[model samples]
Target: MSLRGRVLGITLLLLVAALLSSNGLVIGQLRHDLVGQVDERIRGLATVAARLPSLPEVAVEDVPQVRATVEQQLIRDVHLAYLGPDGGVDRVVRAAAGRPPELPRLDAAAVAGRGGRPFRVPATGGGDGWRVVAVPRAGGDGSLVVAGSLGVVNRTVRQLTGRVLLIDSAVLALLGIAGWFAVRGGLRPLRRIEATAAAIAAGELSSRVPELAAPRTELGRLSAALNGMLDRIEAGDAARAASEERMRRFIADASHELRTPLFGIKGFTELYRMGGMPERADVDASMSRIEREAARLVELVEELLLLARLDEEGTAVPLHLTPMDLRTLAADALHDLRALDPQRPVTLTGPGGGPPGGAPVLGDEARLRQVTSNLVGNTVAHTPPGTRVRIGVGTEDGVAVLEVHDEGPGMT
Candidate 1:
């Protein structure tokens, strides 16, 4: 079975079991009560007849009235008789009967002094039985006996038992249907999540379940987390692709740069080895070109080293974080730039709040200064002779902010 059906089936089975158990108990008690009521009433009528004063003979005229009373009370197959002092029937008042089925043994010997008796007997024209009660009637010489049938009570119990079984079956079926729908409703969110994941695995990165109607449950939380994870994955994948592309371009450029210098050095070295320093001018020019290439190689290697150091020690460098004077640093850098250019001027500006105290940011001051130096050197290398540059520093909302604004092209 599907999950819905399985859950419904299990629930219905348990419910039906409980209902059967309860109904069994109820029907059992009800059957007992019905029989008890019938038997008690029969005993009561028997007692009344027994208490009537009996003469040496019971008149047939009085017998009709007694029979009418028993019939009106719906006691089936009632019979009245007086027993002689010797325990034999002396007179009988019975209506419309061949002979009633022999009653189960009454054990009258046990209750003879109590003036009553009761027992169950096999009944004719009915399924599975009857209840009988016998009472003793007093006479001039001995006592009389009265007996009646309890087939109606037995029949009523059978019908009630049938009806209860039918009701239990109907209730069980209805509950089974209800449970199936309930389980389906509960698992709807899980099914949607499953579909979303499948679509994503099939290369549909945009696939996502709508969260608006999702159940506020553990599964709903799980779906939300999955969506968040997918977002991160997509972002990381895009970054990785871009990084790969940049690395490819950098490798190509670096190879071209290195090869051009090496080729020149190799050609010049071959020329100098073949010809002894024929002319001073020729030797000097060749040496100068080689020296320039060597310097370029050295600069490339130094840049590479700086890049490596930044990667390995990016956020792990040891440094004491304290309030620093950004204005002083900017002023010193501007003075140095002016000494170098003698024309371009550098200036510093910001709100005068001595830099706000952020959660202490840690870094090596020497490395930070190197980074600032590199920025200034790059600006000087590219900008016009008289281009003006400015540095700024401030603090806002517990964060230190710095900006280097130069009147030069920012980037290509």
Candidate 2:
């Protein structure tokens, strides 16, 4: 069952049980007290009836006068009857307000004048039952009996039960209404937490349960705990995203660097296959260039492997700075570009004058060479065959400069 249903159901059940138990106790107690009063009155009237014949003003043989005397002493619904030696209802004197009840066959002890205590009899003609007492009449051969009906007592108890039940039903209904709202109010925070969990499952890692009133309450503490957990989850997700981005950039850079060397080697071998290196010195120079590019490829792989290890240790990759010449790097690019596309016109120049010159600087030579080759490769790939290109190399104001100029359409 749902939380609201369970809570309301239990609350109502306990309340109804308590109300019913209380009603039983109250009605039972009231009936007991009322019946006790009836017993006392009948006992007094029965005592009076037993003693009337002994008084000089009354005779036991004068049934009418004695009956009148007993009736004058009677309480409401009290009736008198006489039992013979055979324990039968020998004669009965009905009262003006009520009649006698159907008395059962007397026990031996009562006919022997031993039944002084009040006893009960079943109802007759749809009437409520009776309380009766029997005693031996003085100077007579039979017993006298007095009885009082319980109809008043029964009616009073029924009225009380109806009132109590009505009141209890109203109270139970009110409690149920109030409890439903109270339970709903209490579960509101849990509903919000449920929604947050759903949102998180749907890939909104940043979703969180809202704050509650204070951490002292159970739900408030739960919301705070859930929000804390969500914070950690979002942080972990962001860290994973950043790591993925770094790996992607690392792989892209690796591919670009690896491609440069592979292209140079392929170009030189292809030129030899076409028998374009007609002179022996031409073949030697191209072979030497191929060997150098291959060595650079090995160095690039080592550098990338070092970077991966340092990244795992959460350390930055350091540059390999040393004294280097931009002109040397530029001259290497000029040769590779000319070999890759012999139809393209390539040149080397000093930025200050018109002739190629050294542009010395402290830098990573392999990284610098890779960057220069990348620019030259971009120029060679985009420009058509026979497009003029320039590799400018010089130092100005202590900063080494290397530039690649292409006579082709510029990027949009």
Cα error of candidate 2 at position 104, Å: 5.0
Q: Using Cα atoms with residue i matched to residue i, what is each candidate's TM-score against the true structure?
A: 0.58, 0.80
Clashing pairs in 2: none
- lDDT (Cα, tens digit) per residue for candidate 1, span 324-397: 54544454445435434556776666534343222223444444544554556666667887888776666556
In candidate 2, what are the lDDT values of residues 343-363, reduced to their tens digit?
888888866447866788989
For all candidates, the clash counts are 1, 0
Relative to the true structure, how large is the alpha-carbon lDDT of every model? 0.62, 0.79
| Positional deviation of residue 172's Cα in model 2 after best superposition, in angstroms | 3.7
| Cα lDDT for residue 64, candidate 2 | 64
Lowest summed lDDT window (length 10), candidate 1: 351-360
Top-TM-score candidate index: 2
Cα RMSD to the true fold for all candidates: 12.2, 4.4
